[model samples]
Target: MQSIAIVLMGIVGMLIGWFVYSKFIANHIFKLDENFETPAHELNDGKDFVPTNKVVLWGHHFTSVAGAAPIVGPAIAVYWGWVPAVLWVVFGTILFAGVHDMGALWASARHKGKSMGALSESVIGKRSRALFMIVVFLVLLMVNAVFGVVIANSFVSQPDAVFPAWTAIAVALIIGQLIKRNFKLIPLCFIGILVLYASVFAGSYIPVALPETLFGLADTANWIIILFIYAAIASLLPVWMLLQPRDFINGMQLLVGLLLLYGAVFFSLPDITAPAFNSQTATETPSIIPLLFVTIACGAVSGFHGIVSSGTSSKQLNKETDARFVGYLGAVGEGSLALITIIAVSGVTLAASPEEWHAVYSHLGAGSVDAFIKGGANLIANGWGLPVEFASTILAVMVVLFAGTTMDSGVRLQRYIIQEWGDIYNLNVLKKGAVATLVAVGSCLLLAFGAGGSSGSGGMIIWPLFGSTNQILASLTLLVISVMLIKLKRPAIYTLVPMVFVLVMAFFAGVIKLKEYWLADNYLLVFLDAVVLIVSVLVMLEAAAVIKRFRRGD
Candidate 1:
């Protein structure tokens, strides 16, 4: 009965989110002008800003938002309990994420495809724009760093998964090129992707030893080096060659993988294994609330989505009205993905005896996540009549591909942010692509310092901080959406409700983190927590100020 309720709640929530509430938000609040020429119409150049078919645009938008973070965050947050985690996915998506994403598209389209920072200045104050840009840049850095670690860890732990993963990407690139060049090779490309997926599973069984060059410095460190090298090359590559093609291919893989996962969970009808509610663990859990909000903030509501939604997607939008479909629908799809992963994790871990579960729970290292995902994959394979190990390997490949897409997108977005900062600062060095690349690379490098694999290490301690950062970013995102809705002289309730919800949750989380740090004896987490608290508070205050300004006709 409870499972039925959850399933029903999720379905209804998604329905309201997509067809009813989201449409209301779009029509009444956004007032998206159909006549207003979008970048696709106004700035079309047969490339990034060219108008595309709705399905193709949807693919682009969905791929941009889908990534490894959605998988990791939900996988970890289920530790809290399936109840809160599921609710977070449901309510958070409908009330906060769906609206925020649609609003971003509407606002950016209104501004002729100006990026979020530019939209911020037009909607909020000019000063707030700079702050928004900086915050966004930092968030992107953290995303790149963490995702980098995510991919590297997968490669190191499941070396056999690498060939199939890279092969899938190679296949995607070929398809993208054939489509671009030949125009009639789409069917062939699709066939190739299917073949490549099967081959990746086959390749996973033929394992080979990883070679170490600089004294036996552990396979993990070697993975990191290899990852950094890939990031460097991918960053330098054009979008058409590696990045875009890989995204298209992996995006399809992600969709199929998610569908299969959900089908497995649903058809198998696994019982929830975790406690329904565990407030005790919820409070002092390894996560700093603020940090967890930042870390897990991606699935529920993310500022990053706004950037992708507005930045690249606006150019390809067939209609201003379609923003709701691409942005809001995409967000809900992601939240659903998160919910599925969380339920799977909670079910598997809870299936074990309480004492055994507690032992694993207490010392849940990074390997624990890999194990959980593998276990879930195996369960699906067992029920579906497939090889368990092969299923697990394919799952690992999908995860790595997800991370790769995220890293490339992060770097590209960060590059643009750097260029924008350059324009704002009036620095001559910023004008040169080489200099902009340097600044962007430096930002990525700094973030890479903390990109240790997600093993609940000290780096994992930063997870909560990432969550906090994302919440703060979401607060800012909400402010932009609300103000833009107001500027269009639309009803503010759609924006107002979500704006208030995100602020309250984010503020509560931040305050909790600050209090914990103040009471703790350790200076490091104390300082880290303190820093997060201050930034969060200031950002919230700024968001409040913007909301007030919007309300007062300022």
Candidate 2:
């Protein structure tokens, strides 16, 4: 079948999700009230809480939650076949991700923009809150550290992307100031795009490369340190100063990139080179049942989205009703990216034939972000007549910028978690923004350098556990939302159904990884995996007890 068919299917599915399902959810299930003052107004401190336009907030939420996972996960999961990967992205987005993301945002906005972990205390119990926060902190650490490495590696490998990558920051700073002065958004958006693409064009001509070693560390390691430092500073800044504008611009860039990719599909009309289901499998490949769900977390449903929804987005929501737009549509935007990634890697753009595609995906974790870049560039070059080098540079910069935004939000969220901890225990030290920022960055740095030595690749060591761990967190977030719905005396079957399915699959995936870690003698992953399982089970038990008590009127 033609790859356009797959594209059409995904587009139609997501449209239905947005226009029909999301409206029903907003009106009935979530019951978002436009008059309800959000935390951004209720707790407006001009630092963390500032009322934001829905469109701008959507951009921040979308780009922050996207990162590289949607690309990387679906890119790799095509090993199972394009059918499973595409279906998961489309249906998962409509049924799972939309509700999860939107619900988290609504829940948080209702609770004064508290993070999901902190909000758990009100809905579930105090014990559940601490357990929930632990999972959240671990997830943030993994995200920030790994994304620092991801951006650093992208800079080194694709030097052309480096100039445009950093140029974006300057554009965002200017845009932020202008927006604060009540500048018109449409014009600023156009100018930002023009400047950004001009940088991309210029970058292709004047590539920037760093030395092999800097400050007695390898270039990648040095880049990692620099990235974390930048993230720390970015996180410390007010949302309007950097995070909001930067992410908004990056989100616009991604929209243009997606249009180019989808245009390539229409013009070139490439054939699906991958099989719907793989009869021939690698010996090392895990079963497709649960693994596929965990693998394609972001494009479908992700726990990380909950973090961003509750962490930063909720704090800036202009109106409670905007949750559907900022959260659910933000999820649809990611699903679109993931869909294009699947086509880029699975269609003739990547491999000329099914056999060639199979060879490229010979192993379980064979295809990745590199494959997406190469394939997407080729597709654009073929269809749009752009030079392959220029196309590659655009896509590379897209990946780097996305990952960088995610790192920014991850560090900020981590600091929030730390501050919440201080409030929970009356520890004044952790309550200070600067001190919390230090602890956040310090933990990620220690994990990177201490675990990976001078190479600073330790984040990847724990990355193998991220897929299962992330999905499990998604389940837990859904669980928290479901509990909130029940407590409010509303229909919770929407959240409850998705929560049950995700938890079962994620739990199974964790068990599978635990056995693999034990056999490989990767005790660190084994211990971490076991801890996640235990905490998840305990949280579930706590929720069950609360429900039981509620039913008993106790």
Candidate 3:
């Protein structure tokens, strides 16, 4: 029954995404003027604005947006029956997330690839643009902070993951440099990924381990420093050698992950191990509503999509017509990837055995980071030919890589935002891109430091912020998208409907949390909760105001 419903949901999601949301993106919202050609085709800069094939672009787009959100969200959300959560995944993708992403692409494309900040100013108001930047800045701060902690936890908890990932990255860097310096060495990159995965399996069997001697220096702090160092180098390096090549090599990790997840589901067919409903789960839930929305945010919606849409993607658009297929359809496809992750994780855990499921959740620290690994260990021991520990280790390596790839992307975007902020605000103190890079790196470091604690366990402080901030950003994005939809003179209600829902759910959640914090004995969470709630509401109200004014034709 669950499988049938999920399959049905996927079909419905795909259909609505293709037909309903995509049409508006391609035809109405992003409709380019007949006189102007897209920069991708007209400018033809090989470095940034070069036109590429759709498939390649899709690959780039998918990797850029795909990360831990989809998998983590559904895994956690399954606490609310697969019915409610899956409904959100399917319906949100079709109506809310699909519209938000596609609309962001179209709006940005029409404006000649200006950023989300610039678009907010030109379309809405200058004040709103500044607010948007401030809001997004904070959101990125939370993102870097959370991901830093997540990676650290994965490594610290599962010591086996650290070597494989480090080795994989080192191998990838060498292969990338070879490919760039000697273009004929392309095949070696693929070979490196294979060798790296094989090494992970071998390490699992042999158990080459690291010392737990960093008693004072938390794992999160270590990750922050490591990520900063890597970012510093990555920022300074040529894209061809590091970023692009590594993405291509690391890209297979996602593919392998999907294949393994799918195989486990079909072969093992593990019963779901979580509860469908429980009040206790809500109180003890790691997810606050604002936080849950933020955490689960990518599959449903995100403002970051707007940044990508207008920044690089708009410039790379080959045809105005392709925006629908590329932008709208592309978002739907991205959502589908998230859906796949959710389905994969959810299938292994269910609503029946909350305690047992909690055990599985705790085992995330036990050399395996996902339900697939935990569930698969049992299944593989029962069904598959491979050893359970070996299979589990393979899954861990893939997850680490998946989380690590996003770190690079996050740094890159953070740098861009810092540079733009410096220019717009006229902060000469920030110097050129070099200083901006440092500032971005420094900011991420501070965020990492703030959450530094018992590696993964103590990092929970900032983890809640991701979902709250992410949802808040999504609301702001919906405002811009709604305004654009109105400007294009489509039925604004379509965009407005989902936009309103996200805002209401997030706002109410934020307010309730704020009250709880205020009434609590702990002033720290009270203060934090108050700030999170207030900022979130202000952003939502600001967006609503902009959309309202745009609608009134004022």
Candidate 4:
């Protein structure tokens, strides 16, 4: 029955969005403070502020903001069909990405941890934190050049998911040397999830490949310059060796690839054959009111999950009421992985046929990662008979371990915003951290070989300016967390009503994608969508002049 009513209405809208984020946004609007002092126990310094483990920092903040941009923006916004992309991924993850990721991990754990570009000038001021760290360094250089062309287009279109996504980087560098000697966490997370499912059954009998051109530039742009030279030496290590045990074995391989695609669609039900409101595929795609709010930014609302909720889950928050279970259950686990990628691309285009779902949605380009890995490998081969190239190599090793833990935490949040702009200008080689991880993986290898267009398709030439600069960085991180809830009076009308609907639908979807990249002239996505609509209209008129000078008292 319509594929068991799209997995029982997306698990009853993620259990009514974690019961309205634990009853009305965490006990009536962002209360949080369970004995406040946080920055991982007052800067624990075991490197990058330690104190984690709220379910391993909610599986490293939901696999570092669940990558593959919520399965390529709701599999190209299911051409505005699947019920307006599942009611904007279930009421935009219960009222705009769970209150802009629990008001950016409760305004960066109440400031000390600081990051939504250093609390956008400590709550809207000081030159608006250098224009909010140059719009968070052009949205982490278009999230490290579109997840370095989405893990080099899932390793040149799934060469058997490059040996179980490089065997979870040698089993997260041997569980970061058994968590640097102390090892014990439930048998090192059950032997690192049994060595990530025996490297996905030894990558189904060894399947790695490359060299179809190397220096002349092809083998998927030399596997995205060897995945940004292993994300510039794993972004200068020491997150307990290899980004916290390779994001705790890629967050148990993203909860064992979303429990085998929602337990094979609730035990093989598979029905909904696409159209739930196609309107002629939203009149040939693009424009489902501000390009479906900038093409379903991260399953619904993501100004880059408030930079992984204040750049790295509020610096590994341990308490202060674990910021509503790690920023509203890590945005309800990426709005239940964008509601299981809109019921696995509308029930795998109802088991494809309309000339293979019009050559994978005729309008929205780059056959949306081959129509979301052939409609989630024909809904896990109708729930059991596996082998659509082994269920598209287990959905291309869960899209290269969720875009390699989002380009390994977008190159450690672009090496802590290029070592905080080299301590605000002195520039002693961007204050070290291996020269800001070699200038953040050398500006993501010069924007992944200069915005790769062909074969490389540098993340599909900026996937619609990474969904309108990720919903204009979620409408300037909900106007800098509604000007830090009007400097703590605490009732900034719940982040000023989704920050005026994501600042007027991400500045009218970056002025209709800057007149469709200036009539296809495509001056680099018409100068990066007119510099993301002029630095999002000067960070929304500097957060409406700091909410009209904090209501006149300024």
Best by lDDT: 2
- Estimate the lDDT of model 1: 0.67
**Regions more than 4 Å wrong, model 1:** 1-5, 33-35, 45-48, 182-189, 206-209, 213-218, 232-240, 279-283, 286-295, 348-350, 353-356, 363-368, 447-463, 515-554
**lDDT digits (tens) for residues 322-345 of candidate 2:** 999999999999999999999999
lDDT scores of the candidates, listed in order: 0.67, 0.95, 0.61, 0.76
Report the alpha-carbon TM-score of model 2 versus the true structure. Answer: 0.99
Quick one: best TM-score, which candidate? 2
Ranking of all candidate structures by their lDDT, best first: 2, 4, 1, 3
lDDT of 4 by residue, 445-473 (tens): 76665555445555456566777777777
lDDT of 3 by residue, 401-422 (tens): 6566666666666766787777
Indicate the worst ten consecutive residues by lDDT in candidate 4: 348-357
Q: Candidate 3: lDDT of 482?
A: 75
Better of 1 and 2 by TM-score: 2
Question: Which 10 consecutive positions of candidate 1 have the poorest summed lDDT?
Answer: 452-461
How does model 1 score by TM-score? 0.87
Give candidate 3's TM-score: 0.82
Give each model a TM-score: 0.87, 0.99, 0.82, 0.35
